[model samples]
Target: MPKTIIPFGPQHPVLPEPLHFSLTVEDEIVQEAIPGFGYVHRGLEKLCEIKDIHKMIQVVERVCGICSKIHALCYCEGIEQMMGVEVPPRAKYLRTIWSELHRMHSHLLWLGLFADSFGFESLFYHFWRIREKILDINEKTAGNRIIVSVNILGGVKRDLSTEDQKWILAELKEIENKLEEVKDTLFKDYTISKRTKGKGILSAEEALYLGAVGPVLRASGVAQDCRQLQYAAFSELDFEPVIAQEGDSFARMQVRYFELFQSIDLIRQALSKIPEGPISVKVKGYPEGENVFRVEQPRGEVFYYFKANGSKFLDRLRIRTPTFANVPALAKMLTGIELADVPVVILSIDPCISCTER
Candidate 1:
């Protein structure tokens, strides 16, 4: 049989983000996968040099639509550190609630797309239908579905009233019940297991060396999660990182499914412990010096670096997104797998090309 090189995609049905791979295949087995990035570069990082620190928050949030809030949160945290501003306790809890809410929405979105990759259209619809509830919550509270800019430098821009909190409690309960129903079918379904199990295997050692983050690293039983760093309100919440030892596509899916419930539990905890106080403190003075902040985003660990020379405009701003870190893992996972399983394998990392390019 002759060896052939096939382009996996700058555009494809299974991938929502643009990622190109030159796959060398022989007898339907991939020998090597060469990756190409920067398809959607918007020069977001460079814009920070011209944009003021406050305006840079909006630009950073647009780095990845799925995890927009987390991006803004990381940027705000870094800037706050540089300015030595202490966030209100209420604002901290609010940040936790919105972060977990976004996590749930993001995981659900990935689940739907993962199912769609394997041709489980019905499951895809079921997952997305439930996701709408989360979007509705975002719109009702933050005034936007995806890029809800609730965070300012000192604290959150909006507050969740007692009545609104009660509504959220009730809504979370309903979403929990709905997820339980799907959970039963998702794990037990023979088709899903057959397609996912033993496919795109990534060992624990390889994952750590490649710097895999979020569920991808968790699935390999690494027990490492950025959330455990006690950032924001996570320190106040009682939670554990979900771990699985399989290190395959199925294990990755299981890790995310478990995280969905974990996020719901974390949200409930935040709501219960939320103290009565102002949502924001007055932010004064320009940021001075340099600092870095790391947050556990839906995909994995996202790092933001800020350098301010006592000015309104940042001297330098850099973002290290999870997708960029996970690309090495993606390349390793593709080697020796069946070419047909490429889409599903690539999706297991939940690569966001926009975030990578930014």
Candidate 2:
């Protein structure tokens, strides 16, 4: 069979971010894939030199809107580590709540986008509509929707009021109900399973060796999660990473779909046990050392490194997003699959190139 070179992404409508992949196919099976970057460069690295450590929290959050809080959290944690600041117990729990809330909405958003990509219009609309509740709750709590910017150097910038706590719990319960309905629909609906099941296969070894993390790694039967580090309140909450053994596209989707419910459950648990106290701590002296930290973002593990020189401005700042680590795995998975299935496979990795390239 003759080989044909086909390009996908960086400008396609189905993709939420710019990621270009050149696939080599023969007789409808992907033979090889060459992925490239440097398309949407924003000079984010250089900006670290100019922006003060405090001011750059907003900049870090903008690395990706869907996981902005996690990004900010990662940045703050790294800085906190360097400064040797121990955040209050209450602040850690609040971080967990917001992080899980982020995971819930992000998964739902991805579910809608995945459905829309396959022409499942009704499923897409319904999922997105259900996601608005989480967004509304976030706006009510943090005064913003996408980039909540609620993370600070020592702890968090926002607090949940008594009334807000009641409302949030009520909202989470409602979202859980909706997720149950959606879960039933997903499992019963043949169209969705038929399109998604057994589409992309990545074995457990390949996932581990290629640096896959979060749902993608979990889907491949590895329970690897940075959350086990217990950097946040996750240590206090009884914890177990979700996993699926099939290692197929459907498994990936199912892992995320089920995690939505788990996140809802987690939020409720956090609220019930949460302690009342100050949401943030004051940081006066400048950090004088460098530290590295990792956090579980909506998609996967995100890395943040910060260096301070006893001044307000950062001496250096850096990040490594999950998408970058997953790219090599994506190339391996795309091989031997039909060209048409490329989009679903890409979505399965949940690539956030904007964050990756930043």
Candidate 3:
């Protein structure tokens, strides 16, 4: 078979992010992949330099809509550390509730996309219909569905009333039941298995060597989870990372499904035990230092660095998203797989290009 190189990104239909990869293919088998980026680069760090701390929170939230609150939480954690402020226990638990809520929605959203990738239109639509519940809860609780600006300097910008908590829990329970139903279908569906099982396989060692994280690593039989670090109220809760040994597109899907259920459990636990108190503290003094913070996003670990010089604006701000780290692993994993599986493999990372770029 004569080799033919086809560019597979930067604005391609298969890739949600603006990534460019030249795939050298012969009869559908990808012989080689050359990856390139730099598209959608917006100099977010420069914006941090000009935007004040309050304004910059919105900027950071824009880093990724799927993991927006996690961005705010991580950025706030770094600032809180620098300021020597311990967030209220109640606030910590509430933050976890919000974070896990986002995670559940995000993972479910990815599941729908993956289902669509395999031409399962009914599954995709069902998943989206289920996801709207979480979005409704987000809007009712956080006052915004997508870009929720709930996190502030010392705590959250919003509060939950007793009635609100009750309503939220009821909604969450509905979500959990529906998700369980979906999970069962995904696990046993013949077509889903046919399309995903044994496709886009990544060896355990190869995954670790390629610096894979999140579901990609979990699907490869790795048990490592950043959430175990328990940076926030996670320490106060009980949860485990989801994993699978198949290391194929199927395993990736399995990990996501398990994680969605786990997130529901986490939210329930948080709501049950959440204490009542103020959500924020007063940050009177200007930050005069540098710091780094990280959080477990739905995709994976996200890191943000900030430098301040006792001014209204930060001297610098930088973010390293999970997608940036996962891209290399994607390239390595795609090397020997048939081109037909590329979309499933790509969706497995749940790639958030906006997050990676900003």
Give the candidate number with the greatest lDDT: 1
Task: Give residue 95's error in model 1 in angstroms.
Answer: 0.5
Q: What digit string (tens of lDDT, one per residue) describes model 1 on residues 156-229?
A: 99999889899999999999999999987799999999899999999999999998888899899999888888
Which regions in candidate 1 have their CA more than 4 angstroms from the true location? Answer: none
lDDT of 3 by residue, 1-358 (tens): 8999988878976566687889999999998988777897787878876778888888888888888989888988888887788888888988998998898889888989888887888998999999899899889989989787898888887888889888988887787788777777888989888878887788899888888778888889999788898877999899878889989888888888888879878888888889878888888776879898877888888877878898878888888898887888888878888898887777777788887777
TM-score of 2: 0.97
Q: Please, what are the lDDT tens digits per residue for candidate 2 over residues 209-263? A: 9998788899999988888898878887776788899998889888898888778
For lDDT, candidate 1 versus 2, the one ahead is 1
Question: Residue 143 CA error for candidate 1 (Å)?
Answer: 0.8
Give the range of the ten consecutive residues with the poorest summed lDDT in model 2. 40-49
Candidate 1 global CA lDDT score: 0.92
lDDT of 2: 0.86
Local distance difference test values of all predictions, in order: 0.92, 0.86, 0.84
Scored by Cα lDDT, where does model 3 land?
0.84
Local error of candidate 3 at residue 238 (angstroms): 1.1
